[model samples]
Target: MPLGSVRYERVIAASADDVWALIGRPERLHDWFPGITACSVEGNRREITLQSGLSLPEEITVLDDRLRRFQYRIDSPFFPYHRGTIDVIALSDTSCAVMYATDCDPRTMALVIGAAAAAGLDRLTEIFPTPIFPTPE
Candidate 1:
């Protein structure tokens, strides 16, 4: 099956380190993601429960602290796409760009995955604290 990809980017008023810190902590996902009610990580795998009482399982595929990038694969029966990546890049002292990308078989559930990503990003922006850093002179 051919893979289809979807991507979303947003500029957040937060440092890369700070954003990474927030993203890296699995247990804190609900704080930034609206639909997610809880998250738990066991070893390299994570389980996320949605507000709708649905639960999804994912495995950490890539975790590069130096580069501030992380990737995971969704193993839930609810999602067609089996994998996705979340990346955070420092744009400035007080700004960072977050990008989420997912590749899945278009024939299966591309639309669902895309819509969920968009909603998740929106919720993340709304719930997370604004980035803080020293003023650039």
Candidate 2:
């Protein structure tokens, strides 16, 4: 079967620079990616621990500051063909849009990953709420 994919995006109230600083760094993935409890990276290799205490190995394919894009591939034997990409696009000085995309074989993996990616985007938005100011009456 061919690989399937999905992309999920969310607007975060924090600046793109702030969002990129954390998301672009593979070591801090658990901070906003739900179900991920911890992450460790060395060179281009990464290992992430899930809520179930299961660990998955991964490879960092690209980390471009100019494009604010982060791409990686899951190396688990169960998931032989999987790629994940995240892009932080600036909407304004104080806000940005986070685009999370995933492609995986077995077709069904796309649905599973899409849900996780959407939840992760939601988590990112929740962490950076916009401030509201009162107007003079």
Candidate 3:
């Protein structure tokens, strides 16, 4: 099966720690992520409810606190072949970037996943405050 990956980059006006704080907080996922109605984490597992009333359970596969990166795999009926990681990098004191990437099976599902990625990124940008980076040189 062909692996489909969509990447998005956004410069936020927050420090890497700040962004990570928000992203790492399971309860705050729906605040910036669209379609997610709620999130809960137990042990190394996490569950999320979608706006469509669907729910997904995922296991935390990788969590690198030093690098501020999180990776997980979906194991639920709500999504087919849904697995991804979110990476955050600090650009400066008041600037940072986030990237989300996913790989799934059933090549035909690429379109749907791609659309979801776009919408999710759009929602993230909308919910996040404006960037506070200094004027570029």
Q: Rank the candidates by lDDT, best first.
A: 2, 1, 3
Output the TM-score of candidate 2: 0.89
Expressed as tens digits, the lDDT of each residue in 88-136 for candidate 2 is: 9998999888898899986698878778888988777667775222212
Q: Model 2 scores what on Cα lDDT?
A: 0.85
1 or 3: which has the higher TM-score? 3
When sorted by TM-score, best at the front, the candidate numbers are 2, 3, 1
TM-score of each model, in listed order = 0.79, 0.89, 0.80
Candidate 1: C-alpha lDDT: 0.74
Error of 3 at 12 (Å): 1.3
**Candidate 1 — worst ten consecutive residues by lDDT sum?**
128-137
Q: Which stretches of candidate 1 lie over 4 Å from their true place?
A: 77-81, 106-108, 128-137
Error in Å for residue 84 of model 2: 0.4
lDDT of each: 0.74, 0.85, 0.71
